[model samples]
Target: MAFSELNLSTELVNAIPNSFASETQIQSLAIPAIVTQRDVLALAQTGSGKTLAYGLGIIERVHATGLQQALVLVPTRELAKQVVDALQPIAAELGHSITVICGGEDVEQQVQRLGDCPEIIVATPGRLLDMIRKQLIDTKRIDMLVLDEVDRLLDMGFWPDVQCIINDLVNRQQTLMFSATLPETLQAKVTKFLNNPLKVTANKINSVVEHIEEKLYLVNKGSKTNVLIKQISEQKWPQVLVFIGARDNADALCKKLNKAGIECEALHGNKDQAQREQVLLAFKQGKVKVLIATDVLARGIHVDALPVVINYELPSDPSVYVHRVGRTARAGKAGLALSLVCHGETAHLEAIRQLTKRALELNQLQEFPVTDKPSTGENKRPKRDKQANRRTNQKTRASQFKGKK
Candidate 1:
């Protein structure tokens, strides 16, 4: 369905493109209620246009009042950037205004931006609270509050900040919370902060995309990297996103992939705002074909024809695996998730399998060795030095001996 059919204010739709289609179920059901001033608890997986769904409503509501009336709280800086980027056009369409405040940016500049009296404030919970404490931003004028990625906010230990923000605006604003899962803690927060919220869930809990083709490659630990290179070469996918588990891993993978002739960049928490913004813009503009990222950078990234997602290393948590693969198969677009499984990671893979409740299809790669040995020419030094290993072994043996004794 089109944005025009939603009965939104013409100015708001004009500010943003009406070409916007209902890409996800939550957007379809919740946008209408939200535009009509209903409190909402929407559950849509990451990368499902949840940002735009709530953004359009917030823009329309604030435009109606001719005052700043909305505050959107996100869990991370990356998400904060994505949310602001999505809403800015809509706000422009309505001749509305917005300001994004997050950590790792200049506080004075944000304070100055607030002086413009923006209609919407998109922020990370802590930064928002900090601004409020400094009396630089007013919650009193906010008429609608949105908690995007509600589950993640709780994960990041933002509950106290969320509560403080909510309490500050309790008198007059409507509250909306969105998450992929609604655990008991989130449920309690919703009850405490939202009054008569309209609940909506699109994908079933702990479920993978029904149409997404999932492939698991069982390769030897040493040969996995070679297998990844081979797959990338063979497919030559238009756009590919790879998920790694740590900042260091993301950097290392990107460097190796780039060295192997793939144009790639890494995104993670360690990047400065400018660097992160540049990398995302580069990826979106197609200057970069592959992006290696930690799951923290996974939630808010939007790309077109991103046909492939490679789990270069399996995620420790299942929810992360869901979010990683979710970068694709968005907007009804068919996509593929290929996980490269190595020997020691089987337990992690098993945990993920149990979490998703689906046995992933395992495939063996041709010409890729599945044995545990490293290639003959490769360095054989232990990841730790001999002395370090000796100390570790001594500790282990001492612990084992003590247990027996």
Candidate 2:
């Protein structure tokens, strides 16, 4: 359906890019409910136009005269910036101001910005809570509350802060929660926050995007980096996002790739906001061909036409694996996901297969053989073979002794 039919302001509609002329399913379903100021819980996959769905809804409801009419809570600082970037133009067109309050930036600067009382405030839970505690920002005036990536917010252990912020906003008129998947723990919180909310699911929960082709390479732990470099050199994908398990691993992997003559960068929490932005900017502009990142820090990243995603280390959570690979093949474009699996990660691979409900075949690279086999409780060698080996050793000793004699 056309975005024009969504009852948005003419200025806001005009602000939308030509590429987004037709509303995505999430936008079509969510815009109307949100426009009416109803509580909404939307479950949609990554890269499914969720930002626009809520951004336009926020613009439609926010009045230029109001003080902090809307509050958008995201999981990470990167996402906070992304949401602000997505809504800023429409906000300008509507003459509504939007401000971001996230971590890693100068808190005092955010305090100064809060003096203006922006109509829309996009923030990460921790920094927003800090502002509330310090009496820098007033939450009593906030009417609409949006929890973008709610699952992620909980995953990052922001539940306590989120609840505290919600309690402060006793006058909230509407609550909107959007996520790719909702775990049982979050359902109770959802019940507590949203009042008679409408639940909208644009796609199946925890389902990987259909357009992504998934492949697994089983290799030894030591050989993962070599295999990754080999694949990058062979495929020559223009832009690739590689997911590592930890911050240090991201940095180390990035260095290894660069030393192997591939242009790469690392995005993780250790880097400050400015550094993170520069790395992302370089990656987006094609200056950096590969971006190695940890899953949590990469929450807000949205790259267009990203051809590939590599899992250097699979996340322990099966759902996280889905989210990691979902970065590719977005907007109906075909993408590839390659995972480097070691013997120890067989369980992780199995969990991913079960969660995605797809038969992912394991392809072994000839150069990097899978030397390590998964361990079972019992020894794998047969008792007869063990006895025969012992007898052969005794015979070899006897023959050597006779020759010496």
Candidate 3:
């Protein structure tokens, strides 16, 4: 359906770009209720137009010159910036200022920005909570609150801070919780914050879109880098996002790729906000061909026409598989999600398979095929071969006839 058909204000509808002729499923389901001040619980996969779904609602309810503000709590700094980027232009049109608050930046600078009294605040929960404690920002004026990426909020260790912020924002009239999958832990606790929310399930919680082509490759743990290098070289994909398990690995993989003659960059929590923003900008502008990032940084990133997402290391949670792959195949574009599964990592892949019904079966790379004891990360000789080699060594030593005890 068209944006104009969502029962939004005519002024708001006219502000949207005309190129957006029809709404995504999430937008179609969410915009109407959000505009009418209904608490919405949206369960949709990544890249399902969720940012705009709540953003438009935030815009529709917010008066540019009014004291009523909106607060959006997200799990990562990348997502907070993504939300602001998506809404800032349109908000500027209506004189609604969208402010972003996250760690790794100058607290004084953020304080100055907050002093401008932005009508909308998109922020990571931790930073937002810190500001709340310090009294640098006022949450009491917030009338609408959005909890994005609810499942991972607890994983991020922001549960208490989120709860505290939610309580401090005592004046919230509408609440929206959006996630690809909402775990039971969050479901029960979040109920108290919502007032009879309108639950909307756009898709099965863990299901992936039909457009993403999922591929799994089984390889020895040590051979993952070599195999990834070979794939990138052979395929020559325009852009690739590799999800590594840890910050150190993300850096090591990026270095390995660059040493192999492919331009790459690494992003993780250790990087300050300026550095994170720079790396993300370079990758988005095609200045960097390969971006190796940890789960938190890659989550909720907005990349257009991204053709591939490689799981260098599977995330700990099975549900995260959907978020990682969802980075590709966005906006109905055909994309590929290649998962590099090493021995002992099949359990993670198994969980992903169970979570989603996508046709994913493990295949071995020709050179990096499954080897004996690979699960232990060592290739050991067979027992018979060792015995034969020991006998040959004994014979050779006796022929030498020189023994030193």
Candidate 4:
């Protein structure tokens, strides 16, 4: 079905950007349910056009009337800004406007923008909760609550704030949830917040799109940078997004990549919102060839036709691996996810394989051989420090007990 057949307003349909094709799987299935004012829980991949699934619904129910009718809760400041940027143009065509509320920006400025009474408010939980405490926004006027990337919100430990916001919105009438991958444990908990929501899974949950090619390389921990630089130079990829494990690592790796003649920038929590936006714009616009980012960018930032995502360091939770590599192979385009695994890193690689449910092929770059042997999992006894050895054994046993639940 086309956008016109989704039952959206003719004006709204006509206003959709020419760049956006008529329909994506998520939009086709979730838009109709939302337009009818029914609560919906939608599951779709990161690059599968999930935003428009609920964006159109919010646009249909609101106009330039100026009372905030839709409230969208997201996981990060980047995502909050991204949601507004995606919907504002289409919304304005129908006489409605959208504003973003997030931390790392001037709260007074945000309050001033809210005074305009946009039809939709896109916000992160912490800042939104702060606004409520100051009585900046009238929750009574919001009727639709959208938990965008709901699973990531839970991953980031926002359930308490989310619940508080829901309770504060005494008059909220409908709820819409959308996520790429949700844990079964969390699914049961979040469902109670909705009213018999129509659950729509547009794609396999916790899985990558079919077109993505997964590659694994086992290397010495100290040789990862050499291998990464070699691969990028060999492939001549126009752009690549690299996920690291920490904010400091992102900055450090970015500097080294630039030193090696690759135009690179880092995105992480340490950067203010303005800086993050500038870095993302550069990466998307082709000004930056490689972007070193932390997991914060895994969920909601969209880069059109990006062809590669590299895991310089795998995430702590295997499920997050889904969102990290999702940066590429978006919008039906073929992409690549290259992972560099060192000796001790095999545990993380194994976790990713388990979550993806694929026997991902492991490779050795004949050029950069891995000389470090993989861990044997055996605890070697220190003959000189008998007491210390006993202490280590006790700690290991306790850890094993904890792992057994």
Candidate 5:
């Protein structure tokens, strides 16, 4: 189905770019439900045009009366900005405006912007709740509430704040929740938030995209950095996103890569908004070849046609492995995801295999052989000193004899 057949206004349909020929599965299913004012829980892939699915509905329904009729709560400031950018054109065509409320921006300035009473507000939960507590923005009159990337928001521990904000929206008429995966915990929250909602899924949850070629390289932890540098030099991908388990690892790996003559940058929660934006812009503009980032900061990253994603360190949770690799092979583009697995991380690799339901074969790099032994699980408990045990037994016998005497 096309945007023109989705019951959208002529202006909104014209506002949609001509490049988007037909509606994606998520968009085709979601637009009709949202236009009819029904709650929706959409489970779609990372790059399946989810932003447009809801953005079109929002523009079609919201009035330009400047009363903040719609609220879109994303997981990060970058995503908030992306959502606003996606909606701005259509919103402008319809005479409605969107204001972004998120962290890492001046709250007072946000307050000043709130005075304009934009018809739509795209925000992160923390700053939006802060504004709500400060009485700067009222949510009671919000007609539609959108929780984009709901799983990520919950993963980031925004449930309490999300619930608090939802409580204030006593008059909300519609709720739309979108996520890549719907865990049981998220399902419970969805039950509470959505009322008789339509569940729309575009692809298989927790599975990698079909276009992505996944490979696992087994190397020792000591040689992970060396192996990574070797792989990058060998592959010579124009743009690669490397995911590290920690922020310090991201910084350390970035430095090592740069020292190896690779133009790289580090992105994490520690970097300020401007620095983060600069790094992303540089990577996007091809000024930087590799971007090393932790999962938290990488959640909001949306790079077009990014060819490679390397897991420098595996996440403890297998599902996160899916999310990390999902960064590439987006929008039906062919991509590659390479995971550097160490002997100690076999368990992690196993978990990922189970979650993704893929028989992942371990490919050993001839230059980077694995010398480390796999964990036997027996060494988890410290070995007792046999000599010390013998001495203790003798001492106990002697003490018992003395007591008898």
Candidate 6:
């Protein structure tokens, strides 16, 4: 569908490059409703163009009114960056400006940006509240408030920060919220913060992308790393993302993979903005072959034609599992999501199975040894062969005797 079909201003529509031609279901439906000045609650899978759906609404409204009147609260610094990057150009085309306020940056710079009176602010909840507390920004002028990834914001325990920001701006505004899943807590927040809202669900809550070819590898824990390496070596995937459960694991796994002659990078919570951006930018540009990350960096990331997503470690939340796989199969392209399941994680794998409601097809490893456990009577660390040991001892004795004589 064309951007002009949404009835946005011609300038706004033209500013959007041809890249956004194939609008996702969420955007196709929600964009028009949002542009009509309706408060929206959009339910769609990650990578479904929800960001641009609401971003266009925020930009169009602010442009028409010619005021600094929009605020978007996101869950992570990376997501905030993605939202701002997607919307800033369109806003610029309409002669509007956007200020990004998130953690891991110089606060003084944000303050300076606020002083310039940007037309829109794309921010993370914590840093937004921090700025508000310091009197660095004014909430009174905000006529449109958005909570992107509301479920994740609640998961991160940003309720107090979100509430504080909303209460401060309660006088009057339109509220738009988007999430992969809407739990009761977020529903309650909607009740308190939003007036009568229009709801739109572009996909079922438990839906998995059918375009992704899902595979599972049931390998023993000891050789899982080798199995992953073998899989990557066998295929010349242009860009691969591996999801580990912890930040330290992500770093260590990247090091191990790179040591095996596979160029890779790690992304997690600890990496500062510059490092994260560098790795992500390089990976997107195909300069890096693999990216190791935790679930924190997985959501709302847009990469073009990334064919492979490996779940090195599964996330506890099923919703996160959906998000991880959704990173691939994006923009109407076919992709692959492969999971490696060891013996100990059977129960966790079962949960994922129940969540997706589809039996995963297992793929056997390629001639790699599986170290399940020692045989019943066999020693884990057996003694060396007796003949070889005896020969070594005899040679040592002869040499000693010769020296003594």
Best by lDDT: 4
Clashing residue pairs, backbone N/CA/C < 3 A, model 3: none
TM-score of 6: 0.88
| Per-prediction TM-score to the true structure, in the order listed | 0.86, 0.90, 0.90, 0.92, 0.92, 0.88
Residue 251, candidate 3: Cα error in Å is 1.4
Which residue runs does candidate 6 get wrong by more than 4 Å? 65-67, 184-189, 366-405
Evaluate all candidate structures by whole-model CA lDDT and list the values in order. Answer: 0.79, 0.85, 0.85, 0.88, 0.84, 0.82
Locate the minimum summed-lDDT window of 10 residues in model 4. 396-405
Best of the candidates, TM-score = 4
Runs off by more than 4 Å, candidate 4? 63-68, 380-405
Model 3 off-target regions past 4 Å?
64-67, 374-405
User: Alpha-carbon error at 199 in model 6, in Å?
Assistant: 1.0
Across 1-405, the per-residue lDDT of candidate 5 in tens digits comes to 678899887778888887687888889989989988899999887778889999888888874222348999999887898788778987887777889998998989998887887888999999899889988887776978999988888888898999999999988888999877777766896678889999998888877788999999888889999998888998888999999988888898888999999888998889999998788778878888889988864554578889999998888988778778888987788999998998888889888888789998988988877888888877677889999688667775555545443
User: Ten consecutive residues with minimal summed lDDT in candidate 6?
Assistant: 396-405
Tell me how far the alpha carbon of residue 238 in candidate 3 is from the true structure, in angstroms, after superposition: 0.4
Sorting all predicted structures by TM-score, with the top scorer first, yields 4, 5, 2, 3, 6, 1
**CA-RMSD of model 1:** 6.5
lDDT of 1 by residue, 16-68 (tens): 65446443566778888887778898887665678877887777677764535
Q: What is the lDDT of candidate 3?
A: 0.85
Estimate candidate 6's alpha-carbon lDDT, on a 0 to 1 scale.
0.82
TM-score of 5: 0.92
C-alpha displacement of 227 in model 6, angstroms? 0.7
lDDT of 6 at 300: 85
Superposed model 5: Cα runs more than 4 Å off: 63-68, 380-405
What is the Cα-based TM-score of model 2? 0.90
